[model samples]
Target chain A: MLKDITLGQYYRADSVIHRLDPRTKIVGTLVYMISLFLFNNLICYVFAAVFLTFVVGLSKIPPKFMFRGMRSVLFLLVFTVIYNIFLSTGTVIVKFWVFTITYEGIQQAVCMLIRLFLLIVGSSLMTLTTTPNQLTDGLESLFKPLKIFKVPVHEMAMMMSIALRFIPILMEETDRIMKAQIARGADLENRNIFIRVKSLIPILVPLFVSAFRRAGDLALAMEARCYHGGEGRTRMKAMSFSAGDIVAWVILAGYIFAVVFLGVTFKTFPEFLVLEMKAGLEYLIPTLSAR
Target chain B: MDIEVRNLTYEYDSGTPQAVRAVDDVSLTIPGGQFVGIVGHTGSGKSTLVQLIDGLLKPTAGSVYLDGEDIASRKFDRKHMRSLIGIVFQYPEYQLFETTILKDVCFGPLNMGLKQEEAVNAATDALLRLGIPRESFGASPFEISGGQKRRVAIAGVLAMNPKILILDEPTAGLDPGGREEVLGLLKSLNESGLTIILVSHSMEDVAKYVDRILVMNEGKIFMDGNGKEVFSHVEQLEEIGLAAPEVAYLMKAVHDAGIPVATNITTAEEACGEILRALKN
Candidate 1:
């Protein structure tokens, strides 16, 4: 059951996005995240959504899986929408005894929800197409100039890649330890909250012990093989930007331009415009509540 | 506790492109109270097959029957099944993390819902059976010797009072003396009516202790018989990357050298008796 965890899981596939330089994908993802918060209008959101859909298609990752990823954060999305709807101050659309739903509140809630969903989907696409090794290589290359400031870029990338590689191995160890505990009659299921928390001790303790043991063994093995802090080291597969990477950059630039143009031209949505016009008519007509 | 596997098949990473068929259309009935040894090269499905018997794995196809009840059935409680069949995994010392040897050994019984006092008593009895000192019960397990730690880990499983004990390479990485100690404990457990299924690459250990041997190759059982019968087919066994028991090989050489000694020898003592008889003739 633990195997279903797909956080930062890379699925290998031969596609345009998968073929793009890892450096390009990494930089593009950063740019996309920055641009998400920059655009606020409905037209810009539409443009962003379309651009994400096109990229998702090119990556050959099923839309269903992307939606599945979003499902994990669905609870937070609903909570945000509900909180904004009742708590924000604006012209009331619906009035109860003490609670009122406002026009601006609904607009902000929808915009925020869409923004969060797109953020997760866009970043997930980057991870899904790029291997962990390639991603780290990209990070090292991108941050190589920082070495002038003595930032230890190579060491950081090496550590991150090693950590990423061991995640699955550690997860597998955790599963084995849990099974051993279960065999011993530790009931992890159908217990009270306190008991359940206590039950995890058996699994976690062994997991940590084994993790440390593996780390020590790995260090010795690396040292025995003469590994020394990534200095004067060369890679077998060097990173290079291809034609596909350039095309990807061009498309990303076009997406940013479209978002910027739509953000400037579209001041308000038609639905909000209609709501304001209706409120103006309400002011002209006398209401029984006003009496 | 007899384990009856029927047409069992398992696939790793099922539904993914990287899926692999680890176990395929395999079925075997391991009789109750028999010390069965499973031998296979790495990745030949020995580990996967044993895990199936204890319900650590559910077969993609077919089922496992323990004491004639389908273990995969919804009516069957897997946790209770696991308690009935104790599996001491390879490098079991890695599973040790308790503050005291007693607490670590008592883990199984406590999980079985035994009272604290009852669990402690059971752990003590198990430790005594495994030849661990009673005074060492309160000591940290990490401070113990490697062999003692392994015994303590096995005692943790023995504390559950399981009927069938499945050990995966119990003697792996141990010195000869340590290997003998662990194997001797298993031999005593078998004498006390506990069924043992030992998975190992050491043909010598299996020849000395196991009642029956099951040889696996490429995810299928290549041979299943008593030690003598399995070892007698030295050529076939060697073809699958397994060698006959040393006694068996020596006897085969004696027979090939024109001696009328029996080739069905598996243990050194049996081979010695055969050689004496041959000399008398």
Candidate 2:
């Protein structure tokens, strides 16, 4: 049951997005995320959503698969939405109990949820399309200039790739240990909060020990093969910018341009759509409350 | 405590593009008190099959019946049934986490809702039966040798008082002596009427112990019979990347060398007796 983690996992496919240079995908994710925070209005999100949908379609990964990845961050999404709705001060739309629901608060909540959703899914898309090795190669290339300042870019990239590789392995180990304990009558599904928390001790302790043992074995194996840092290492599959990468960059630039243009041209949505939405909500809320 | 698997199938990562049919449609019935060994190449679904039987995994397209009741049915007490079937996973020694060996062994009985005193007694009995010395029970599990730690892990499951014990590669990383110790212990456990389903990659190990053998290939039970029946088809077993026990090959060599001995000898001891008789003749 623990195998549902999709974040940081690459989905193999022969698609335009998957074929793009990892550097292009990484930079595109960063720029796209920055664009989400660049504008405060819903019109920008319309463009953002269209772009994400187009990229998601081009990536060839199943929409269901992408949404499944969102399950891990669902709690954070709900928490942030609730936090914005109750905490922000504005013209109060409804006041009940100790809580005040403001028009501006609801607006902020919607915007925040959309922003967080787009940000997470956008970044996750990048990882989903790119292998961990490709990601490390991209990071190493991007950080190559940092080496001029005495930074260990290669070492950091190597460590990151190793860590990413271990994630699935460790998850598999955790699942095995959990089943073993369960077979021995470990009651992981106890309703009591304290007992449930305490039940994790069996899983966590064994997972940690096995992880450390694996790490030690890996280190020894690497040393035996004379893996003495990335200084003199040569790449077997060197990263190169293909024609698809250029097309990706151009699409990203166009997306940024469109978002900025919309943000400048319309502070919020166009007047008519907003009025129509408000009218629609005015007619919708009361019948629901009457029921 | 008999297991009846009816058209059982399992898929890993179901509903995903990467879904793999780990266990295809399989039907087998293992009676109570049977010593069965499941042999397959790696990824042939031996482990998955055992887990499905243990109810650790829900089958995608079939049902497992424990004592004539569908284990996956809602009304069935699956948790209680699970407690009756102990599964010692591969590298079970990694499951030990308690401060002391005795406490670790006590985890199983305690989780089964046994009283503290009763749990301690069961744990002590299991440990002693597994050949763990008394003084070592108070020591940290980490301080024990690898084989002892594995035995303690097995003892932990034994403490739960399971009627059926399913072990997946229980002797995987042990020395030859340790492997013999574990297999011998399992043999005696089977003698005591506990159904033991041993999943192993070693043909020699399975042939030496289990009364019945199931040869799995590509998620299907390719062969099912006693050792003599299964090992007799040495050519077919080799086609699926498996083999008869090494002694069977030795016997085959002996038979091919003009001796009138049978080539179906599975164990070294049996091969010895047959060879001595043939030489005397």
Candidate 3:
């Protein structure tokens, strides 16, 4: 049951998306998030959707698997849509005793839901295709420019990579400790919720203690290896941007431009113009009817 | 409580691309009141087999019968089953978090649904039996020595009043004196009619304490018999990266040196006596 959790899960596949430099993927994800918010029209949404679909297909990552990432934040997405529909005010389409449902409210709610869903899917695409080590390496290299500010960029990347490496180890340890407690007749499941929460104290305290102990040991080991930040440290595998990376960047940039252009020209400007024309027509229609 | 594993098979990461068969189809009977020692190198399925018996792991196929009842049956109470078969995992002392030794020991019986008074009584009795002082019961478990901490952990399991007890590498990382003390405690527990299953790397301890030895290799049972019978196949044991009991090795060496000594000797005391008799002759 614990194994099904896909937080920081990476799917191994030999595809162009998987082969792109981790640095490229990270930057691409940031740009994709920006483009998702830039699109306000249905046409722009369609363009973004089709682009994501093509990337997902090229990555060979199943669409069903990508959707699984949405399951965790599914409740939040629902909450956002429901709140937007009820609270947003515009031209009322349906009116009750005190509440009004507007046409624009429905539109805003749908757009908000789509935006949140796309954000999760796009970020998940980055994590699914990149290994934790590679991601950290990319972050360190990207942050190399911050050396001017002395931000300890390399140390931060090293720490992240180490944390990722120890996740499985800690998981296995937790499993063992949980079983040990169970053997001692600790009924973690059968107790009342309050008692269950209290019982976790026993498990959590030891887990934290051991984690700190491991961290201390790891620090000492790293020190013994003469690890003094990333200064003068040469990497075993050099990061190189290949032809696939360049093509990926080009396609992503083109897709973002199209989404932004369509959103502005078709959705925002047309909606503004239509509202203005509606006001003018309202006055003309009343006069014509009077005549 | 006897544990009967019938056609038991387990696969790690089942249904995943990285799936591996850790425990292949196997059948074994661990009779009530018998002390069985399981020995294997790392990744030999010995640990997996023990976890199956204790129900820490559910087999992918087949069933585990505890005293003629299928443990995997929906009607079975898992907590009750676990209480009945107490398991002391390797280096289990690391799990100790209770403020006092008594409270830590009482944790198990309380989980078994005993009243606070009854749990305290059981914990007291267990600590006393394990040679911990009544005064030490009130002290923090963390304040004790490593050996004392280990005994406290074992006493924690003992407090549950299990009919069958399983220990994984109980003697690991212990000094010779501490090892003997812990093994002796287990031997006494076995003598009192509690079925014991011990998984360990120390062939000497197993030969000295257990009635039978099970040799595991590559997720399959390689051999299962009385200590003398299992240790007699010196060549096979060594082939699988396991050494026979030192007494058995000494006996075999003496026999091969043209002495008429028996090669199946398992205990050090018996080997000493036999060597004395051979010298006199």
Best by lDDT: 2
Candidate No. with top DockQ:
2
Positional deviation of residue B172's Cα in model 2 after best superposition, in angstroms: 0.8
Clashing pairs in 3: none
Cα error, candidate 3, residue B194 (Å): 0.7
Comparing 1 with 3 on DockQ, the higher-scoring candidate is 3
Better model by lDDT: candidate 2 vs candidate 3: 2
Ranking by TM-score: 2, 3, 1
Each model's lDDT: 0.85, 0.89, 0.85
lDDT of each residue in A1-291, candidate 3, tens digit only: 456656578988899999999999999999989887655666777777787888889999877678767788888788666665665567888887777887766777776677777788889999999999999999998998998997989889988999999998788788888989977767678558988998887788778877888999999998899888777889899999999999988987787677767867785556734543343344346546756
Which regions of candidate 1 are displaced past 4 Å? A62-68, A88-92, A97-99, A102-104, A265-291, B72-82, B217-222, B229-243, B246-265, B268-281
Query: Who is ahead in lDDT, 1 or 2?
Result: 2
Q: How accurate is candidate 2 locally (lDDT)?
A: 0.89
- Candidate 2 C-alpha lDDT tens digits along A40-143: 67878888998899999999998888888899889878976786687656678899998999876677778778888998989999989999999999989998
Worst 10 residues of 3 chain A by lDDT: A275-284
* Predicted candidate 1 versus true structure: per-residue lDDT over B1-281, tens digit per residue: 77899999988888767678888888999877889999988888898888887887778898889989998788988777767899998888888889999999988988787899999999999999889998899999888998899999999999999999999999998999989888988888899999999999999999999999999887788899998889888889888888988888788889989999999888899889999999899
